[model samples]
Target: MDLTTLTYIVVGFTFALYIGIAIWARAGTTGEYYVAGKGVNPVANGMATAADWMSAASFISMAGLIAFMGYDASVYLLGWTGGYVLLAMLLAPYLRKFGKFTVPEFIGDRFYSKTARVIAVVCLIVASLTYVIGQMKGIGVAFSRFLETDYTTGLFIGMAIVFFYAVLGGMKGITYTQIAQYVVLIFAYTVPAIFISLQLTGNPLPQLGLGSTLEAGGGGYLLQTLDRILVDLGFTQYTTMEEGNGFNMMMLTMSLMIGTAGLPHVIVRFFTVPRVRDARKSAGWALVFIAILYTTAPAVGAMSYFNLINTVKPGEVGAEASNLLYEERPDWFKNWEQTGLLAWEDKNGDGRIQYYNDGNEQFAQTATEQYGWQGNELTVDRDIMVMANPEIANLPNWVIALVVAGGLAAALSTAAGLLMAISSAVSHDLIKGIFNPGISEKGELLSARLAMAGAVLFAGYLGLNPPGFAAQVVALAFGLAASSLFPVLMLGIFNKRMNSAGAMTGMLVGLTSTLVYIFTYKGWLFIPGTNMLPNTAEYWFLGIQPESFGALGALLNVTAAYLVSKVTAPPPEHIQHLVEDVRVPRSAKEAPAH
Candidate 1:
């Protein structure tokens, strides 16, 4: 079969499997809908957590970021991975022991203030909504390319799939479906990596292949070869960090780590297990599953980058005959061009694509004067690198089709998780907890499904006009989570004297500061061109990008909370005792009711 038919078959089968799982595991009650009835096995929950945690940002965009940004993107890998460790070690078991259905519920009850709970719900909704937009964008990109639909149409199809499984199954259905998704995504991710690794380095393991010598051409170490290739094209060396970027990188990494811990969707995963001990066990298993892809990402990024450069510049950099002829471009190039993610312009009427760094004035001058190149003639969206990698390598039609399925699975799995967090915050935390304490369980469950449907529509609309590529948008979401939620959650759990006044104040301060900074650069509410200042280093406060400002915002949150709580009355004695109780290990049966 041709590639298009095969993609339809593979993607169709995965979708059918997801909906079937959702039907089988459809939730029957509030508990099942919110926390999978608290009966999930540790290993199974771990796999499900992996699927939920590794969104399109991880599967579709991280490698792409690594390919383009080189050493600067290492922060994503470090921050996200380290942040999970922070969650597993510092937060998960304690939160699981508190035995709440949602993060906002824990906050409200812990702080003994409904206002605190409402603020947390707002934070969760904002962060989850922002995060889900990235997933929607990834879905759109995959569908637009493989299904031959427009971006908006593809996004709607993805939204419908999410609505079906997420609304019907809730956490119960999503958990089981995510397990299958994890398998599909991991297989799809690794198979291509392994194939490309062997092809490039004569090694089957992508991890080892990254450090191995190139099996063809000049036969240098892979990193060295890649570095030389990039530098020759006026790009920064692939393995070296640019000077003056250290601070931004450090802040970005810290933001991502704390943001990971604060994300309500991932935190809720811990609540699915039956016991606190199981939460810890599941966290360990999740780390293992997550590491599988994280470790392979660098190799995939580097190899794909190498392949891309080789294809575009066939022989030598800056050589008149080296540039690939526009009409002779590979099928993958034409395919992506139709999606508008890849484009070429014949500057200087050379009839060849010149893709060097036009921003490097020194190199641009030389290219124009010596090589008769006018400017950079190609625009390649970084988000397309991973999805297009298999095709670029001329992999089998089935492999390319499998990649489409994997990208959709990664995007949809996290989209479901985030929508769950948003819906639960609205229905369980806002409606049942605050507005209508006497609401019936059935009513709340129905409200949760309706909330999810609404969230899907809102997120899909934002996906139609994303502010950035998949991973950059996700980084902004992480910043929101880190600034708004992580500090308050940590204080609520670790500080016995932490009061409602302090918790509420901290959340508002962190969230407001971070959002304002982000809006000033990323546009108010992420509407493009609404930003008051240019999103460049020269315009940044202390050279901190909006995405890296979360750590600073989090610090402000902690400091503000501390000062505010010092003058206020401490928590009630019982609340302090409750905090003490949560710190100690106990069975789920022994945990006190919220």
Candidate 2:
């Protein structure tokens, strides 16, 4: 079958699988809707958590980002995975023992203040909404390519599919659906990595292939060869760190780690398991599943870069015959060009495509004078790297179809989880907990569904008119979560003396600080043309990127909470007992009194 037909079939099959799972595991109660009735097996929950955490950015864009950013991209790998360790050790088991349906509920009960719960809900919404915007954009890109639809149309279709499964099944449905999604997405991601790895290095494992010698008769390791080619083409060396990228990489890693631990969607995953021990084991299993793709990603990045350089320069780098003739470009090139993702302008009318660093002033002289070149002629979107990698390496149509399915799976699974987080906060925390304490279970469930529908529409809107930081918005989302949610949650559990006043004050301070810093550079609320200053390291406070500012915000939260707690009365005796009970798993599993 052709690419289009195969894509349709594969993507169609995955959708059917998800819908089937949703139908099979439909929620029957608010507990099921919120936490899958707290009965999911540890291993299954772990896989589901992996699917939920690995967003479209991880599946579709991360390898591509690493391909371009080189070693600098290690921050993402470290930061994201590192946070899970923190969650498993410091957060997950205790939270699971607490047995709350939502993150805001824990904060509210721990602080003994409805006001604190409301603040936590707002923080969860802000963090989750920002995160969902990125997922929606990813869905649009994946659908637009494989399904041959416009972005807006693709987004709506994706939203509809999410609504079907997410609204009907809630946590119960989504958990099983995500397990299926994990299988499909992981298989799709690894198959291409294996194919390309074997093609370049005679090794089937991409992680091993990255370190192996090239099969193309290159003189050194594959990374060494890649580095040589990139440097020759005036790009950063593929394996070495480039100088002067914005932000401290360590600090950036910490922010992402904290953000990962703090994200309501992720933390809530632990609540679905049957026991606190299961929560701990589930976290470890999640890391194992995630590491499969994470370890292979660098290999995919390196191989794709190697393949692109070799395709464009089939011979010696500067030779006239080395460039791929514009008219003779492959079918894959034409295919992407139609989507406007890959473009070329034959500057100087050379009739050849030059893929090089045209912005490198030091190399411009040699490029133009010696080679008769007129700067770089091609503009390939970084987001297309992984999607295009299979075609670039001449992989079969089925592999490409699987990639489309994988991207969709990754995007949709995370989007569903985030929407669930948003809706639960609105319905369970805000409405049922505070506004209408007497709300019936039936009314609460309806409210949750309505809240979910509204969140989907709002997220879709944000996807269309995305912020300036849309490309890097996942990192920003992490920042917001780390700053606002993680610290407060950690304090609530570990600091029994922490009062509602302190928790509330800490959350507001952390949230405001992160937002102010981000908006100052990324535009006020990311509005176009509203930035107070250019988003550059030179203009940053203490040379921190807005992405890394989460660490600072987190620090402020801790300090502010501590100082405020010293001046305020300690949490009531019951609240202290509640904290102690959460710290140690109890048999009764009842909510402690206020």
Candidate 3:
């Protein structure tokens, strides 16, 4: 079959499978809706958590970022994976033991104040909404390319699919659906990597292939070859970080780590398991599943970049004939060009696509005077790299089609989890916990569904006008979570004397500070041209990028909470005792009933 038909068939089958799972796993009670009735097997929940945690940011965009950013992008890998370790060891089991349906509920009960819960809900909503927008962007990108639809139309189709399953199944449906999604996405992701690795390096394992010698035109270690090619084209070497970027990298990595631990959607997955021990077990299993992809990402990124550079410049660098003629461009280039994610202009009327770093003035001058090149002639969106990698490598149509399904699966699974978190915050934490304490279970479930519908619409709108590419947008969401939620959650569990006044004050301070800093650079609410200053490194506060400012905001949160708690009254006696109990280990016989 042709690519288009195969893509339709594959994507259609996955969507059908997802909707079927949703129907079969429809939640029947509040427990099921919020935490999958707290009966999820640890292994199944681990798979579900892996699917939920690895959003389009992981499946679609992280490799894209690595393709363009080179070594500087390693922070994302380190930060996100390290952050999971923090979540597993420091937060997941303890929170699961607390026996709450939501993070806000734990804060409220732990702090003995409804006000604290409301603030926590606000933080969760903001972070989750920001994170979901990236997923929506990924969905749009995948659908627009593979389904041959406009970006807006593709986005609408994705939104409808998510609304149906997420609204119908809740956490119960989403969990099982995610397990299926995990299988599809991981298979889709690794198969292509394996193919490209064998083709490029004669190795079946992408991880090892990255270090192996190239078997094609170039006969050097893969990364060394990539570095030479990039440097010859006026870009920095691919294997080394640019000078002066170390501090920012460290800060960004720290923010991502803490933010990962603080993300409400991932934390809520732990609650789906039956016991605290099961939560820990699932976390370990989730890490294993997560590692399978994380380890493969570097290989994919390097190989994709290598393939892209070879395709665009087929001959010696800077030679007139080296540039690929615009007329002779490959089919993948034409397909992506139609999506507007890739474009070309004949600078200097050369009629050849010169994809190089025109920003390097020395290189630009040489190209202008010697090579008769006017400027960079191609624009490639980083987000397109992974989705286009298979086509760029001339992989089979089925492999390409599988990638489309994988991208959609990654985007939709996380979108469902995030929407669940948002709706639960509104329905369970706000309406039931505070506004209408006497609300019936039936009413609460209805409200949760309505809240989810509203969140999907809002998220769809934001996706239409995303602040950045998928991974960058996700990094910002991580920053929000790190600054606003991680500190408070940690304090609530570990600091027995932490009071409502301190937790509330810290959340507001951290959230507000991070927002102001981000808005100052990223624009107010991410509206283009609304930023107070240019978002450049030189203008950053102490050289901290907005995405890396979360650690500082978190620091401010901790300092403010510590000072405030010292002056204010300690938490009530029972609340203090509750904290102690939460920390104490329980044997199987002593475990609390679900």
Give the TM-scores of the predictions, in the order they appear. Answer: 0.99, 0.96, 0.99
**Candidate 1's residue-wise lDDT over 239-290, tens digit each?**
9998799999999999999999999999999999988888889999999999
- In candidate 2, position 352 carries an lDDT of 86
Q: Note the residue pairs that clash in candidate 2.
A: none
Local distance difference test scores for all models: 0.94, 0.89, 0.94
Inter-residue clash pairs, candidate 1: none
Candidate 2 accuracy as lDDT: 0.89
- How far in Å is the alpha carbon of 199 misplaced in model 3? 0.8
lDDT by residue for model 2 over 217-315, one digit each (tens)? Answer: 654799888778788889888777768664588789999999999999999999998877899999999999999989988998888878877777777
User: Residue 52 in model 3: shift from native, Å?
Assistant: 0.2
Q: What is the lDDT of residue 428 in candidate 2?
A: 99
> How much RMSD separates candidate 3 from the native structure?
1.0
